[model samples]
Target: MSAILSPRPLIKENDVKATLLSPDFLRVSQPKTFRHSIDVYLKDSNATGNIYFARHFEWQGICRERWFFECVSADMLQSLGVFITKEAQQKYVSETFAFQKIDCEVNTFGVKHCSFSLLFRFFVGGELVAVGHQQIVFANKEKKIARLPDHILAKIREYEVEKGE
Candidate 1:
């Protein structure tokens, strides 16, 4: 039997930060139309206390520096399903299949109209593709749940959030 190969490593911390600092990552644009809807739940379990918002459907899988917080919930993590795999994340950071956006807004509280990006690296038909400079935002006070179909949650559960010391 053949063994599986691992995805490429994430971009170097220095390089990633450098990329973020460049003028290329600084420009953001407001979309002409809304894309996706992300539901938010407050820590109090009452939706009324906090505001939550998601990118209009048009923004997903597009930006490089993607982030989700505030209304961040296990359900939100679960919604990503298999798409949140380690390999997928590696692919994302490595710019394999790049997703990027500009001037995005998530207006609830803390995270008002923040700029974001995401990068990816992946293999297709045994060939490599690197997608770079992707970004997105989730309004604070509002939580976003990625909403995945059943069966996919199994893989989603393996994902974890990292905190800085």
Candidate 2:
């Protein structure tokens, strides 16, 4: 007889966020968030009818592009040169079944000389399913790392302050 393996479900009552907080008051603030929805298609599912692991990255890309076009202008992006992905990380809290609608919320949490970070959270039916973080760096037309343009940075700062972040 052959053994079949199935994905394990995340157990409740173990709130990951609670374990990481410090007792001392840390001045933490939420970023301005952008929300987008992804409708899972058959092509995005695996044999088990759950969304394929790699599809999460694809959805994240969609969310990121939507955010860029909405919050900033495509022409502005072109004028500023290119933004390249530096690093990406994700933590899957639960599985998403096929045909489900996943709500993705994204926000910029950190910015620096030539790079910025976007945090993404995926939820299914109001339950947190995954969290992702991506770092992107500005680059020149020659593909060399470059400092973010002041105008763009100023716009981002204005948006952040407007959102009370």
Candidate 3:
């Protein structure tokens, strides 16, 4: 068997920051949409009541799962294998608070032999709050990197094309 290489970040940190700051960042339409409501208990706030930085990732997880099921069938995903996050990065634009309902728009940004990238835009009350990028790899039961199934890839492409319409 050949050695597996780790996935690299598709965008540099500086580029991510620039993209997040752009006026059109949140304006870009994504193929898949997931909505989430922030609860008081999820707030890992300091004395000043600002949410902890890490909580953003947890919210991303919620959206990710929803996006997966929405775009691809859960049964198909289970039959193929598990998708693992090879790398993830987030850039926060504005502070978010409890009781805010956010819309997470996600798109299959890119695809490779063994992995794919998902870009997420978090919008709260029409304001951009944060942007997240995740590189996910499909792994078989043996935990070895596996190629994406053709059916799944086709579904992703369909969504991408639909988004452009």
Write candidate 3's Cα lDDT for 14-83 as tens digits.
9999999998986866454445555544456766767777888987887778767776776647776789
The true-versus-predicted C-alpha distance at residue 154 of model 1, in Å, is: 22
Tens digit per residue, CA lDDT, model 1, 45-163: 22344221122222334321132322223344433332221122222212212122123322111111232223332333334432222233333233432433334322222221111
Q: For model 3, what is the error of residue 22's alpha carbon versus the real structure, in angstroms, after optimal superposition? A: 34
TM-score of 1: 0.20
User: What TM-score does each of the candidates earn?
Assistant: 0.20, 0.74, 0.69
- Candidate 2 lDDT, 1-165, residue by residue in tens: 997776764644455455555553454653466789999988999888988888889888998888888875666487658989889888899999889999998777577778787788899999999988788888988898999878777655532422123
Q: Highest TM-score: give the candidate number.
A: 2
Q: Model 2, clash count? A: 0
lDDT values for all models:
0.30, 0.78, 0.74
Best first by TM-score, ranked: 2, 3, 1
The best-first sequence of candidates by lDDT reads 2, 3, 1
Best by lDDT: 2
Q: What is the lDDT of residue 157 in candidate 2?
A: 52
Please give the lDDT score at residue 22 for candidate 2.
Answer: 50
